[model samples]
Structures are given as structure tokens and as C-alpha cells.
Target: MNNLDKVKKIVIEKPLKLDCGKTISNFPLAYETYGKLNEKKDNAILAFHALTGDQFVTGINPITNKNGWWSYLVGPDKPVDTNKFFVICANVIGGCIGSYGPNTIDPITKKKLATNFPVITINDMVNAQINLIDFFKIDKLFSVMGGSMGGMQVLQFVANFPNRTKTAIPIACTASHSAQNIALNELGRQAIMADVNWNKGDYLNSECSPDKGLSVARMAAHITYLSKKGLQEKFGRKLQERDDLKFSFDADFQIESYLRHQGSVFVDRFDANSYLYITRAMDYFDLVKQYNGNLSNAFKESKAKFFIISFTSDWLYPTSENKEIVIALNAAGANVGFIEINSDKGHDSFLLDVPEFLKSIKNFLDANYKIL
Candidate 1:
């Protein structure tokens, strides 16, 4: 938080009316960029971040001292090949990493917005980031891509601004949030609220934080990111530095320790309130309903080419959901391609080092860019 001002950002002078009927103005939208935008500016690619992911897509994240979440893909000579394309990523409006969110202080009140922050939707997030496009004076983006919640934003972006991008890649995401996923998110939310320290999402001014509850939430959600096969192969019933169980409540298996470590580290870099607001936005996403049950209508106006990708083992979004988008694109007569990469890594496969998956993206972007 002390280094927040150090993050690159722009203050949007235009008022943004959120889906919850609240209007926000003069808010900061933090972002990070890679490579350079050529004279034509057609080399620009907008990359969206998933849940809990900030704008740091590649290289070292100065805030956490860890590798950026997408370091494996979006770098010089990598799949995205920032050397050839200028990649732009922004912290979604409901995000905590220097973006306007619950942790952001109200300039008027001089207090953290906290629970007073109005709920935002995926549509609102895309609308807020569009200001960045205008700020840079890019007439049309070369590409827009993301996975999971990031993918949802890609869909929303195209729907809102059909002529803004040349290509769209929505990987491992759905047009609408499924009931099961909503329930899973609710489970995480309950864990946070159960912590007395949460204090109804107004704990910013307090000394104690709801770290225990947040850690448990992360542990539970992390399981969904992996496949049963992947988990078995990686951890199995392996004991954690012991020949036998400790016979107590402490972590006895390697898997337990792994989950605890993930949860603990996540709490350090993330704000609990941001997690709550972002998940709620994901749940409220329903592109089909927005178009009156015809998902095809969502993209009917977009001439941009689309490429949807999915993993074989991703049960969270699953191949079915990704295919649905392809099907809708087909119905709309939009130029679209679909691929299901074989992987045991589950929903997080897109974020990992999967050669075939990376290669496909490179081929798509490179081939498309050449045509331009």
C-alpha cells in the first residue's frame, strides 16, 4: 500500500455509472505495459487479469517480490511475444492493486471506502479500462486476451466496443457464471465474514485482520484450480517431513502444507474486501441474459476474430463452457476458432508452462498480425 503511488495509473475524469446505480468519478485505474506501441499503434494487445491477479503480467512484481502471474507467456520472444506486441494490463476497478476499490480512500470523505464501496460488475470493469484505450489514442487494439475471470472481461469488452479490437481470445471461461461456481465463491465469502475481525468488511482501520478466514478461503479455492489427477500425482498421501502423521490438527500431509502456504501468501498481497467485491462481480456476470438469452447477440456486432481455448481437465470452467462461446460465435457468423489442449493441470493450466497451449496462442497471434 505504501508503494501504491509508485504504480502506473490514470485518473478517469469521466463519471462511470456502475451496475449497482452508483457513479464514480476521478478514480485511478492502475496498469502496467510491456514492449512498445508502434507508430501505427495497431500492435497493442489488451491483457486482462483473473481473480486476485493484479496488473503485473510479466517480469517481477515489485509489490510482492515474486514473478508476475503470467511471466510464462507475456514476455519478450514468448508466446505473446511482447517484442512484437505492446501488451497492456490493468487492475480491474474492484481490484486492490492501486485501482479504485474498497481499499481506496474516498477523496471526499478521506476514509477507506470499505463496505461503502458500491458493487461493480464485469461490464463496469471493462468500461473503466476502456478509458485507458482512449487515453493512449489507439484506434483499434491488435488483440484482447485473458483466461478465467479475465476471459469474462474479454467477452464483455468486445460486446461493449465491437470495433475496438482486431482479435479476441477468451480462454477457460464462461459467458455466464454457473451455479456451482457461485456456491464455491459464496463458501469463500462466508469464511471471510465468519472472522470476527472482518467487522462487516470495515476492518481497514483495525489492527487485526481476518487472515485466518482468508487463508481458509484461499485453501478451499486452490483445490478447484487443480485436477484430481494432478493433485494425486503431485502430493498424493505423502507425509510432510514425517514418517507418520503427527496425530494432531497440524498439517500432516504435503498437500495440507501446500494449501496453507498458498493461503498465507495470498492474504499478504491481497485485500480481503477486494476479494469479496471481485467474486461478486464474477457471479453477477451473465452475457447471455444481457442479450436476452441469445449469447450470439453479444458478439453479433463485433467483426473481430475470436479464438477460444480450454483444457481437458479444467472442471471449473470446463471445455463445455468454452465450447459454448464457440458455438455462439458460430451462430453469430463470427470468425472463431476453438481448441481443447490436453492437460492434467485443470483450470490453472492456462497460467502454467504448457508448450502446446503456448504454441497455439503464438501461432494465432503471429498469423493474425502478419495478415495486418
Candidate 2:
């Protein structure tokens, strides 16, 4: 095959013991690949996805009929440059889009796992990925890159497989969530549980699903993805259709309409129980604690080149928070590069049409990946 480009559904037979003392014998993972692995097996790169993202990192998404989420950065001539490296993106263990989550069929019961699914952590997620990487027969990944929750996985990969990753790029995320972010996630879950049709995460057994609750949750979480300046610049308290206030509770402002649309469309695609499982995984991701409260020790064995990026207006994961990681990397005496791009787009800037950010990524990937 000129390009090993396709989605692969794989199952690991060996039991993987999670950090929480739980063990799973057969874990399923969904992954997509692009370009071809060199005969030397040194050109493979694994790209992690954000909280709601899937393994469809490039090309057309069959379900959505839209371009892959990271198409801007991962195509043949794009920043990641598939012409040079083989890229693989795997859906996280607790994700719903074809991965083993609440929606997966439980062999024992012959039914969906639902609330019965095992609680997964970021460490568990990376463990599953390590299995997938082993299946690909690659001794080491050339680089691993991701942003937001995906970025959390990148750090987890480095922490757990220090020698396996040659280059690590974590962008727009913290090693752990702040109390405030945890609170926001809690609010989303509460919204879902409050719906009568939730049925405590077993809604699949019933005719009713918590569509409304899930929509509200998505609406709430979507706001944190943008900057205050971005919100003002895009909507700015502007009235929707009438150009004047509607006295009733209808969506009078453009931002309200925008959020409602986002929520509605999200509910059509995502499942409520899957949302709960994945968000809980993100909340429990704490790298420093995994290394006994010393963040530097987490990277003690990391020989990978590190390039960390953050956005200036991203309050969700502000530059100061990202610098904590950079400082820790320095303490570990690792090769690292840190940059905070000045942007009004906030945390979503990495996904948007930011020229400077894209340029920086292109430069970083080009410099870090040297042909062996």
C-alpha cells in the first residue's frame, strides 16, 4: 500500500491494569492512519484528539460529511506533513465514536455497557494507545501531538512511555484541571443527570434519551472554548433577528442563538452517558500526583524534544498555567520550547484560522522531525 490510510478497529487480548486497580482484558480501540510507515518503522506519529474529537483527524468524516477536525494541520502538505511522516489518531478509550465507551457492547451481557462501563483515566487512555502502537509494530513514535484534553493525553503518553515518544507537543492545556474547570464540568454533568430521560445513564434501554439535558450541557461547555474578546468581537450583545430586544425569554441576542445552535447540533451527534464518562476522565487527569506531587519527576525519563504552546487569551488554560509545565520540563533538563501565541480566539485559536499559530506549528514540526 502506497499509503496505509484507513480506520482500523483493533482489540487488545492482554489485560491492561489501570492505575485505579481496575483491569480490562479485551479493550477495543478505533484508529485512523495516513501516509505509509517507512521500512525502518521510525516515521510514525500519533496525534491525540480533544475531549469531543475522534480518530477522524484527516480526510472526510463519513458521519458528518465535513472535513476532518484537524484537516488544517495534518494533510499531506500541511503542518504535520503526511508526505514525511505516518500519522495515526486513535479515539480515546472512553470516547463514543467507535471506541470502547458506555456505548460499546459488553460481551458478558450482550448489551451496551452504559453506566456499567469501567471508569477510565487519562493513564488508562494512554495505556490503550500503547497497545495500539504495539499492534502497529512500531518500536517508538516519531512524535506525539495534541491540544486541550488531547494535550493531556500527550503528557500522559510522555509520563508513562518516556522513551517511546521522540517528540512531544502539548498545546492549549494544563497537566491537570483547575478547580474552576472541574466545577464547569460538574455543571455539565448535572445538567445531563437532571433530565428525566437520563435514567441514570441507561437511557438506551428506554425510548427516551436526555437530549435536552445533553444539549444544555454542550451549550454550557462551549462558552469556555472562546475568549471574552472573541465573544464580544463575534456577537457583542448584538440582537438576533429584530435588532431590538424581545421581552420574552426567546433567544434575543446573537450569542444566545449561537449557543442554542451549538447545543442542538451537538446533541444530534454525541451521547449523554459518553459525555459523562469522558468528562470524568478529564477531571481525574493529574500528572503531578501520578508522580508523587513532583511534576519534574514525571518527565525524568523523557528524552523527547518538547514544544509546548498556549494562547494569550485562553483563560481555560492560561499562559501562566502552561508555563508551569515548561518550568517543570526545564527542571528535568529536557529539550523544550514554549511559546504563547497572542490571539483573541482564546482556547479554540489552535483550531481556527490563526496564521501565526499555523506557521509556528509548521516550523516546529519541520525542525523537530529530522529524516533518519
CA lDDT, every model vs. true structure: 0.95, 0.87
Candidate maximizing lDDT: 1
TM-scores for candidates 1 onward, in order = 0.99, 0.96
User: Which residue pairs come into collision in candidate 2?
Assistant: none
RMSD in Å for model 1: 0.7
**Model 2 lDDT per residue over 29-98, tens place:** 8888999999988889999998878888988876566788898888899888899889999989888777
Looking at model 2, residue 244 earns an lDDT score of 78
lDDT of 2 at 295: 91
**Which tens-of-lDDT digit does each residue in 2-52 have in candidate 1?**
588899999999999989998889999999999999998999999999998
